[model samples]
Target: MSYLQKGNSMIRRTTAAKGLALAAVLSLGLTACASSDDGSGDSTEGGGGSSEPLKIGTILPVTGTLAFLGPPEIAGVGLAIDDINAAGGVLGNDVTVEWGDSGDSTDLSVASSTATDLIGKGVSVAIGAASSAVSLGVVDQFAEASVMQISPANTAADLSGYGEFFARTAPPDTVQGPAHADLIMGDGHCKVGFLVQNEAYGNGLRDYIQEALEAGGCEAVYGGNGEGHEFAPGETNFGAQVTDLLAQKPDAISIVAFEETTAIVNELVSQGWDFNGTTYFVDGNLSNYGEDFDPGTLEGVQGTLPGAQADEAFRDQLTTWYSENESGELEDFSYSAESYDATVLAALAAVKGEATDGATISQNIRAVSGAEGGTEVKTFEEGVKALEAGDEIHYVGKSGIGPLNESNDPTSAFIGIYKYGADNTYTFERQIEGKIEE
Candidate 1:
């Protein structure tokens, strides 16, 4: 079966099991106003009161294409919020969050509408639209409304140039792309094959990889969009594409795709391809393949990403929290850590703003995360202290510390190299600097 057919089957199965009411809720048009209550917990209030509580809006793919990644991202946000509240809330006001699902749509008009509704209800900061395409769709709306949007996992190259009001924790695809290409071409490889998804995320990686490969004196044997069908993030069945790629007999194959790449990996293994000699290079989106693909099939595969695995200190804290909470097992992915950092940064910005308004919050973000100050921020408390002292703070997060350029994108990110082991686990090989020139 083709990828499109596989995607359709999965959606049908899920919808049938969830029933019509849930599906209706999922597909319902964006509501203009979300019901709100005043301090008395009754329906009477003009503003939720500047002194009452802090409201933050979150947008993530909770139900559709990128659903697998949403839970961890949301968990990270929740963790940051809990930690802040436990520490006596920001600026002495209780913090609250309202969440909306983005459903992985390329055109995020519905999600943008949801954000506007959150703004109407008085949220000062918004975090999410996990997919880059979705983030790109709603950036203008956030800018128009003066809402500070801090995305946890938007890596598209175009987003940093969106506006001053937007910020992303994840490094752009351009940074990750060249790193993967270097890993493949630097291994004395001559020719490589490419299988890319037809989207901004896929094309961005493809462009960077091609440039890096050519620079490294490697040639591309087969380069184009992956065939079989257009599959959303979680779709399966890439057997035909893999079979065609195997026919080319390249030294390596670069998969600039997502979960669909896992299916191709499976097909390659099933066909008894020479795994010892041929390499499979995947982008950061395939970081979670261990959870989705057969363990034995992924042995010897390689992947590149912008950040390292959750540091030991942070993982210990998260493990303790999960033991006391009902959020379930946390997967080890870069986005989870980035999500926590983004939320913390935004909250710090809000506290720095003092008034809890988006414009003030946006200005504070640039002040704290930018390079006007010394480039080091160790903890949330230290950031708060710096902001309180009227000193420009450079927020160093779990991802890394860097300056946001004119585009609002971080100028650099730590690049991590990972290899898949026989047990279907990803082992961190090493870290490199992702430095790109304008």
Candidate 2:
């Protein structure tokens, strides 16, 4: 099947599953209500340790091929807000989020405009533009406005290097790709093939994985020919590409695409190609596999992603908070844990900066991450303690230890591997440590 077919198939499948909810939300603009706070009509007015409410904006794909990733990611953000508010809010003020959708276009222009609008509404800090392409487009706008933009899921390497104003909770492709490659190659695989989307995230992951494989003494059977450059989502057929890939007879194959992963898996299964011994690799996007593809096809497929929320001690507390305060269900998705952490970090930064403005918040982002002389911190209490002691702190987050290098990418941690089990379950495999090149 061609890339176009794979995308088409994905659209059809997602539409069938979510058409009603999408239509309902669109018609009523209830998508905007996803961030609605449960409060009476009374206004709580104050600022900077006053009783006023602090506003934050979130720009995520509420309606797009990547929609499944949005709710969970937002849930993380919301859970953070709930916890902070219950404990007297940020700096004694309530924090509320203004939510917007990036839509299916995922265009940077749209994202920039959205960010501009949010800044106009006086959001001190913003989280999201979940898609890297969309975030890249709007990053400059946020910088110009002096509004801090922290992405929960923007893992493109370029975003971190863009400026200090931009940061992300997720590790970039530099770490993620090598982690996947190590797992694929460490299994004694020699020949490898890659399928990548023709975007920054996809291309970067493919390049890093290829480099890692080569370093491990494995040859990439198919490289530089765009043999696997598929752009767009909801593609249904990948027969032609699969046939080409099978011809290479690689010992393993890594797919660096989002949203359309299940289609590729299903197509491979349909063609009678068993993945039993052949390693199949996926990135953070694999969290959506169960929801996007038939469970039967996904069984036994191996996926490499950031540490799972269930596997983290801090996430247990988060899960409890979410269950008690939110009406939505929570799951372990790519940016869910990180998104929550980003909000908490931003709020803590605001408190440390002694101001809730965007510029101060952005400047203090690295501080919250425990850069400089900052003490190693994680929870709100740790940060407060460090501040009280007048010490620089490093935040080892629930996501991982976030020691961003000069490039603004994380300098430590490993990608976790998991395998799909029966009944749409996932089991932990192992951690693949990644080396940073350059």
lDDT of 1: 0.65
lDDT of 2 by residue, 1-438 (tens): 111121111101122224334434444442222112211212112123212345777877766667777766766776677656665666667677666565533444445445655665566678887788778777777776666778877777777678866877777887877777777766778898776667777777778788877888787886433555555554667878878778888777777666677677777777777665464656535663455545555566687876444456555655664455443555655567778778888887777766666656665667667666567775766676677577767877667745666655666656778887544456677765554454
In order, the Cα lDDT scores of the candidates are: 0.65, 0.64
lDDT of 1 by residue, 316-434 (tens): 66655544443367665556777788878777776666645565566666656765675466667777677667667788777773666656677778777888776777788888877
Worst 10 residues of 1 by lDDT: 3-12
Deviating ranges (above 4 Å) for candidate 2: 1-53, 104-110, 223-228, 288-296, 308-326, 432-438
True-structure lDDT of candidate 2: 0.64
Top model number, lDDT: 1
Colliding residue pairs in candidate 1: 160-407
Q: Evaluated with TM-score, which candidate comes out highest?
A: 1
Give candidate 2's TM-score. Answer: 0.80
